[model samples]
Target chain A: MSFDGLWPYIYIAIAGWLATDLWRWAGVVAGNRIDERSEVLNWVRAVATALVAAVIAKLIVFPTGTLEASPLWLRLGAVAFGGLCFFIGGRFRQIAGIAAAIAFLAAGLALLGV
Target chain B: MTAPPESQSQSHWFLLGMRGIFSLPAIILMLSFVGFAAFTAEAKVPVEQVMFMTGMVWALPAKVILVGSMLSGAHIATAFLAVTLSSVRMMPMVAALIPEIRDRRTPTWLLLIVSHFVAITAWVFAMEKVRDVPRGGRVAFFAGFGVTLTLTNIVLVGLVYGAVSEFPPIVSGCLFFLTPVYFLTSIWISARHRVIYWALGIGLALGTIFAVVAPEYDILLAGVVGGTAAWWGERALRRREAAR
Candidate 1:
C-alpha cells in the first residue's frame, strides 16, 4: 500500500497503543500503594467491562464486515446459544466455548443454505 | 518476596501452557485473526505487512479497522474514528490490570510497550491467573503467553490468507461471527453489576437506533447515553434499596 494509505493505520496503531498504555503504566505506578479491590478500582473494572460490552453489543446489532451480511436472527440466535454454552461451562470454559459455538452454529446455518 | 500461598501451591508450567492453549476464546481469536489476515491479503495487503502489524502494532480490532477501511475505500478520518472508539475499551482494561503489576522496581515506560499485547485473552488470563503468580513473574508469564498467542495468530492469518480464495462466502461470514458472539457471550455470562448491565443494554439499544439515523456518532452517543444512564440508574436503585 502507498504511504498515504498506510498513514491512518500507523497513526491509529500508535495513538491507540499510547492511549491504552497510559492506563497500564498508570496501573503499575498507582497499583503499588492501593488495595486492588478498592471501590475505585472496582468501579474502574465495572466501567471497563461495560465499555467492552457496549462494543460487543454494537458489533452484534450493527456489524460491518461479513457478519453484517449474515441473517440478523441467525446471528442473534447464535449469540444466545453461545451464552447458553458460557453459562453451562462455568466462567473459564464458557468464556471460550461461547464464541466457538456461535461460529459453529453460524457456519452450520450457512451450510444448510439458510 | 514470600510466594503467595496460592501460587506456590500450583506450579504447573505444563498446565499453564495447556490452559492457555485450550482456552476457547484464544483459539477463536486466533482463527478469526487468520481469517482476517487471509481476507486482507485477498484484498491485496502484503503478508509481510500483516505479520509486522501482528507483532508490532498487536491490536487486532485496529488491524481489522485499518484493513477493512482500506478495502472499503473509507476515509482515513472515518477509519481512525472507528478504531479510536473501539480501542477506548482498552482504557478500562488497563485500569483493571495496572494496579496488579505496580511495584518499586518496575518501569512504567517498559510496561507501556508491553501493554500492546494486552488483548482480551491476555486480560482474561491475567485477571484469573495473575493473583496466584508472584508479582515479578506475572509480567514474564503474560509476556510468554502473549508471544505465543501472537505467533499463533500470525500463522493462522497466513494459512487463511493462502486459502482465502477457496473459502466460501458463508464460511468467511462464520469466521467473522466469532468476535460478536464471543463479546455477547462473555458479557451475558460474566458481567454482574446491575447498573453496568442496564447501561450496556441501554447503550446498545441507543447505539443501534442512533446508528440507523446517523452511523458516525453511534458509538459516542451510545457510550454517553449508556454510561450516564447506568450511573444515574445505579445511584437511584441503590438509594431505593437503602430506603427499603
Candidate 2:
C-alpha cells in the first residue's frame, strides 16, 4: 500500500493509543492522590458517563450501514424491548437485554419481510 | 473498614480471577467483540487492521468511532480527536478501579500496565469484586481477569472476521446491534447517580436532534451540551436538598 493508504493506520496507532492510554497513565499517577468523592472527579465522571450515553444515542438515532435500513420506529422498539429485558433478567442483564433487542429486531424484520 | 483476609496464595487468587471471567460478564464481552468483528468486516476493514485496533485501542467505543470516521474519509487529526473524545470516559474508570486493587507496595509500573486492561467490563467487575480480595491479591486478580479478556477479544475478533461471510444478512445485522445494546444496558445497570439519569435523558434528546441537524459532530455536541446541563441540574438539586 502507498504511504497515503498507510496514513489511517498510523493515525490509528498514535491518536487511538493516546486517546485511551492517556487516561490509564493518568489514573495510575493519580491512583490514590485524587479522592473519588472530590468535586472535580465527580464532574469528570458525569461528563464521561454523558459521553457514553451520547454515543449510544447517536448510534440509535443516526446509525450507519445495515442498521440504517431498519426504520426508526423499529430500532426504538428494539431498544425499549431490550431495556425491559435488562430489568427483568436480573443477574446477566447485559446479555439478556442484547438478546432481546436482536430477537425483537429479527422478528420485526421477518414480519415486515424486509 | 476492616482488612480483608489474606489470600490463600497470589496464584490462587489469579486463578480465581481467570475463572471468574468465564461467567456471564465475559460472555457478554465476547459477544460484543464478535459484533465489532462483524462490523469491521461489513465496513471492509482488513482483518489484520481490526486485530491491531482491538489490541491497541481496547475500548469498543473508540474503536467504533475511529473506524467509522476513517471510512468516511475524515482527516487523520479529526478522526483522532473523535476517538480521543469518545474514549475520555476511560479516565474516570481507570482512576476509580486502580484504587480498589492498589496498596502502597504496589509498583507504579504495574499499576500503569494493569490500567491498560481497565475497560468497562474489567472495571465494573474489579470494582465490585476486588473489595473481597486481599490487598496483596488484588493486582493479581485484576491482571488475570484483564489478560484473559484481552486475549479472548483478540481471538474472537479473528474468528468472527473469517466467519462473517457465511452468516446471513439478518444475523450479521443483529450482531452489529449487539455492541450498542450491550453498552446501553451496562450503563443502565451501573447508573448510581441522578446525574447519570439526566445525562442519559438529555443526551438521547440532543443526540437525536443533532443527528439530523449536524450529522458529523452530533456525538460531541450532544455530549458536551447534555453533560454540562446534567452536571448543573444535579448541583442545583443537591443545593436545594441541602437547604431544606
Quick one: best DockQ, which candidate? 2
lDDT of 2 by residue, B1-244 (tens): 3544453567778888888768666787787787778778877888878888888889877888888876887877787788876666676667656666877788888888888887767775675577788888999999988888888889889887978655665765676676568767666666677887787788778877877897767766776787788888899999999999
lDDT for B18 in candidate 1 is 39
Q: Put down candidate 1 lDDT per residue, B1-244, tens digits, no spaces.
A: 6877546533443246435755766877776786776667677877766765666546676677666765676665666566666566566677667777544465767566557667766776666666666775666566666667877777666666766756766666767767766655555545555765776677667767766886765655566556666767777788899999
Worst 10 residues of 1 chain B by lDDT: B9-18
- Top of the candidates by TM-score: 2
The positional error of residue B144 in candidate 2, measured at the CA in angstroms, is: 2.1
What candidate 1 gets wrong by more than 4 Å, as runs, is A1-35, A85-104, A111-114, B1-19, B72-82, B103-105, B132-136, B187-203, B235-244
Q: How far does residue B12 in candidate 1 sit from its true spot (Å)?
A: 8.3
